[model samples]
Target: MIKGINKMLTKSKLEFLVGLGIIILPLQGLAAAAPTEMTKDDWLGKLKAVAPSVICQGFFEDASLKKRMEELKIDNDKCISLIPASFDKCQTQYYSGLPATMNKDSAAKWGHTIGECIGTDFATKYLVSNPQASTSSSSDQTTSSSTPSSTSPSTPSTSPSTPSTSPSTPSTSPSSPISSSTPATSSDSQSTDISRDQWLAQLKTLAPAMICQGFFGDPSLKKKLEDRSIDNTKCVNLIPASFEKCQNELYSNLPTTLNSDSANTWGHKIGECIGTDFAKKYLLPTATPATSTSSQ
Candidate 1:
């Protein structure tokens, strides 16, 4: 009886030890799987290093887009300096915090982890809205969206045929002086409209306003024009907020150099730029600055 009792106790002890080991092993594995978070300073430093690649990736050739990226970069640096970094609840936070507009391609480009995207978005917002946290929090904000749609509908037709009597024909008549002059006037108007459209299209693609004021001194615009002429164009109303900022800068800084007409022309050029193929590339949401492994 004594031997049986001792054997039972040993077996139970071995089972308990095995169970405890199983539980602890998984916990240790989890700890290893979890990633460490970075401090704001280290994260921002990494971002600063990677920023040129991020900003220049899509539309660097366009001066207006480059200027906007530069403006954002300034705010990015300031925000990273001021804001503390934290990403503990990455999975839970990312699911809840992701923007409605964020897509898979964007995530692949910007996300270290899904949660990092949320952290980035928050950082950008804080940086963009609050300047130094000491100055008033009245931030300059702008929003834009586009929806292009075209549809064609066909109408059903019904007709009835009836017998008719022969009718007398009218005598031949010469062209009237009014009709003769009308063709010339119409031709002149059409020519003027075509010329205006071509000019506006070229101006829009080139963004002459940003280019003209030392923003982008690409001689390529003139070269492109000489190589291939623009004939057809679509008008656009939306322009980047940076254009307004640039205009204000020009007016305030160089009052004698840039007039209202010049500003207006630049404004139109910006509008035209927004209508091009590159607009979609440039308009994509900017990804957040990357986080550092050692930041935590």
Candidate 2:
């Protein structure tokens, strides 16, 4: 009986090996395929579902990455499995491939959460260091001083050199009080409410070209801006139609690998929120009129 059982087991094992060999023979010559290209809508979905903040945060300097590798005990072999790899691949694919499926509004809110973890100073530093970045907007200071008065009966001259110093600059001792009857400028239709000064101040900048009211999605962000008296009207007046236009330009300009929507979504994902929310949550209130430092 023992001899018969041994014979049966050996035969079964041999049959299984033969079956496996047959299955493997046809596929041996083919190379593995690359990951499928992610579309913008796909990225918007992921970003909405899973925020990329954890991966995108921190100093991306090569030395910093090496240090992080040591601290995290990351095996060199496993680095490809890490989200940081996605961050690195941004040049090849534009955005972290992980962010394509996010909801735009939620992406904005979660960005604030990440900003809370890192201070605002870090946020600006990260943004400023980006190779493809643009100028920081001193929107309020600029428009407050530079914008023409919607209150003025006079039309704004369009020449850039002539600087469209709007209805009033602060130093001017205008004879008339800013009147309610002052005609609405064409820009006024953009927002439903708020004074022109406050409105223009809301216009914030994004890297590579972006005009976004993305923060309006967050109640806390809204309250913070409100505390600072930032409203949509001022934002509209200062930015005008630049918001959507900037979004497209910035989106299109993302690294060649990423699709446009993915780039657009990611710009809102990593750039706008980090830059703006960091100021809103961590930096602004603590900012002193003198040295801008933090408190314990």
The prediction achieving the highest TM-score against the true structure is 2
Residue 135 miss distance in model 2 (angstroms): 40
Please write out the lDDT profile of model 2 over residues 1-296, one tens digit for every residue. 33332233222121111111111111111001112333334322222211122122112212333343444444332221232222222213333432553333332222222222222222222222332221232232223222221111101000000111222322112221111112111121111132222111222222211211333334554565466555644432433233344445454444443321232234333333334333433226553321121111
All candidates: TM-score: 0.17, 0.19
lDDT of 2 at 220: 54
Q: What is the alpha-carbon lDDT of model 2 when measured against the actual structure?
A: 0.25
Model 2: runs farther than 4 Å from truth? 1-214, 236-253, 256-274, 277-283, 287-296
lDDT of 1 at 2: 31
Q: Highest lDDT, which number? A: 2
lDDT for each candidate structure: 0.23, 0.25
TM-score of model 2 vs. true structure: 0.19
Per-residue lDDT over 1-296 for candidate 1, one digit per residue giving the tens place of the 0 to 100 score: 33332233222111111111111111111112112233323222222222212212211222332343354453433322222222222223443443443222332222333222322332233322232432232121110001010000000000000000001101000111112212211221122111222222222322322222211112332233223321111111122333343334433433232222333344343333232322232221231111211111
Whole-model lDDT, candidate 1?
Answer: 0.23
